[model samples]
Target: MAGKSIIDVLENIPREVIYTIVLIAMILPLLRPLGLPVPVSEPIKKWYDAIESLPPGSLVLISHCNLGAYPAFDSMQVATLHHLFSRPVKLVFFSIDATGLVVYDTLLSKVDPKAYGKVYGVDYFHIGYIPGGETAMKALAEDFKAAVPSDYKGTPIDQIPMAKDIKDIRDFTMIICFTSAGETSIGWIRQWIVVRPEIKYLCCVLDMMLPTMRPYYEAGQVAALTGSAPGGEYEFLIGKPGSGIKKADAFTGAQLILLVFIIIGNIASIAKRMGKGGVR
Candidate 1:
């Protein structure tokens, strides 16, 4: 190590070596999570709290709005489904966009409500994709029966035991909307919240939508606000670790490794400026 200055060693780290180190940092956690301390953020806390407080027979409405963001929203939706199914609450599923139906199979396959002993018509139901976007939102608020013609399986809504009693937006004790089309989210507020205002609404959007939607939470229009980023926190709080937890571990490991490289790069740059090498 004498002939090669510290700067030289740091700067000459093989590209493959750097990549391998990063890969290891990411892979180890997925294989065996270190169970690193996960600080629960306020947003995740609020969302978890809302779910925890649901009455035994409370009915909850779930709407997934992102058409092409399964990679982005999968953890949030999966962790949420796990938490909900863990409780004795009922759930109704639908999509704001027609394209979002692709998400149902992926999400349900991961959650597998049967594993939780959830019977389809009794505990939960998926009403499939409703195509009207904001227009759909308004109709849903005024009349749930009119808006949803049949279950996602094509069974008439009236025939579905769990859905038979659902009258309008007012029937659901809480409304949880995953990050979706902005207007569609606002449509829920205008059509549902503005008129009723008692329904507990939590808007789960992407990290970027926090700024725009945070005010709704602050204004007490939305019961709680969360996003895709801190989805792992929900898992931690509920004591059910899944994709969110694994993603959190991998993410933390990768970031720390990148930070070390950043620090080493800065040190090498400073050493050069101080004339440690012959070139300087």
Candidate 2:
């Protein structure tokens, strides 16, 4: 094997074989995760601590604005919901985007609050989707009930014991936004944060939007943030490994395979160049 040219071996390997190996690497993790250790980032740790530090009966407002990027943001949502539900906080959920309504329902179904001993209209309340964008956020900041009269299911806000006392955004101890849209957080900051500066604000955004949010996080506008991979990190931190861990395993495996291929290709090229020179 040492005598044989590495270039010959690598160059002869078919593209189909490479593709099959990559596919297997991705699928095998989904079936049985490798349970890879994901390092918790500072931002994610802060996000976790922000929630953990909250008093048991503290009120939390979750503003979900992700629309078409559910797959990317769903893990974070699920993990956050699990974390929140595991605690004794009173939660009020509302969506700024229309598509977020469906996202909220899907997320709720995945992280069934009832399973965590959370009762509907008591432990948590969903205000459904509000349509005024930044304007709606401003309105909700001033008077929550006036902005949203009913829950997602058409139950009046007053009917939900948890929500009846939430007169405005200031009533909540913390406000967290899980958004896919790049501009959604800005809207929250401008509308909600600006009005109620005392309330701590946290955000979970798509990984791609991390760059756009770093400045906000740095400026103390966003107390904490968890974007993309940090979702898995949060899952790991919370000790509840679900789809995020599985996805992280697949992601790690895929990257390793790609790296191996790149190294092999480079080695094969170098060997080929040496062989040609020796023949000359």
Candidate 3:
């Protein structure tokens, strides 16, 4: 029997070794983030631009419904909130999903508005969790104060000072929502968007739901619609490193390692085929 050639030896490399290499690639970044470059996509650019275009004293209504995940809700939520608070925009936050209340607290704890020199009731305030899913959106759209007469903590809407003039749905320069629920996300378009054609809506939803909501973005009904896939790109654009960068590094590292292995395997296969033929 003929001894193995170089191609044969290469093709016979152990699968366990490849798996171990990929595992190591993913883990090393989590321990110490490599600060790898994450390219910004067009949608992410649109999202950032929408926020950046906000003029001073621009009112932005914020909504989020995210049950926390390590890098899912963590990256975009923290980074975007930091960007929003850094500016001079006035924000009003509310939650449609009941579970999102917890996310609100956790999110705020990480990026405190006060730290950005924002006063709670005036610059930003949470309206807490409004129970009715789509119905709440409709009511809030038609009558901002009638829907919720008080702030999240039961403070009267009139007392907040900033929220006092939200008499019209068109009052806000934009409405930003980070959501996982199809109802709340799509509901924003149906309820508020349809009624007020001019209001810009920025949506950051779960990546899995991107395809379902992408039509709106393409049609231009949604100012910007996206998910957390390129969250590291967003962080870099905003100049804050968080879970996005770490997550991107881990996944990219594993992928690059696997890609190298796949390329090697294909080359070995071609070499073996040529060696058996009269070609080489």
Candidate 4:
């Protein structure tokens, strides 16, 4: 009865309908759980199998590229870290973003307080926050001690038992960057991967950015890329849906609902347009 066009009313209807559809999409997948078989890519499979093959006490470098408004990137990073840590890998935490320290500290506390408690410096260490974006990373590749004199806790690197003999980046086996930005990933590749071709690099990147980073993947510069929530969820469904996977499913459902709404709106728009044009 209102003067509003039929298209407008139809669009509005679909908007509400979409909410219900999204709920169904999410609830269904979560409840029924597709149990989709994970077709492991060679790179991802290599990274997984390689980490799993680590001799129980191998050290892994975990880099929080930067802090974000949402914890999606952080969640993905932590999920992968959890996977490795769950396998009992020794890890060291460092952040390129100053804001990341807060999130990292909070995440570490919730994920594994006991495992973290066991190896403060020996098995696990937080190098804390560092300065100088790419420049700092470049310096670290050459001489880590010169770049960061002390860990995030202000403990002198010389004092930490594990860091005593570790003078540079080469000390670690792999460099794992959980980042969304190009600079962070590229920096690692330029400073470490390019310089130290023998060392491995894996990225836990956000979903939208996956396409952008695909070139690196094709170039074989990145050893592995854990794509968005699908990657996280696949890992989870395989025995792991980390928060990344859970959030990914939610993201997928949201997109589906949006698409349905768009379709419905177009249909209503056509109907209204013809009605206004003398029922042609």
For candidate 3, give the lDDT: 0.84
Score each candidate by Cα lDDT.
0.84, 0.84, 0.84, 0.71
Across residues 201-262, which tens digit of lDDT does each residue of candidate 1 receive?
A: 87888777788887888889998887787878887888877788888888899889999999
What TM-score would you give candidate 1 relative to the actual structure? 0.80
Residue-level lDDT of model 2, residues 225-255, one tens digit each, is 7686657888889998877877888888888
**TM-score ranking from best to worst?**
2, 3, 1, 4
Error of 2 at 259 (Å): 5.2
Candidate 4 per-residue C-alpha lDDT over 97-136 given as tens digits, one digit per residue, 9 for 90 to 100? 8887887777776578466345678777888777787888
TM-score of each: 0.80, 0.82, 0.81, 0.79
**Deviation of model 4 at 92, angstroms:** 2.2
Candidate 3 residue lDDT tens string, 99-186: 7778888888889787899998889988878888889988888888998888878998889988888886878789898887788788
Between candidates 2 and 4, the TM-score winner: 2
lDDT for position 263 in model 1:
94
- Misplaced by over 4 Å in model 2 are 1-22, 65-67, 257-280
**Prediction 1 global C-alpha lDDT:** 0.84
Best by TM-score: 2
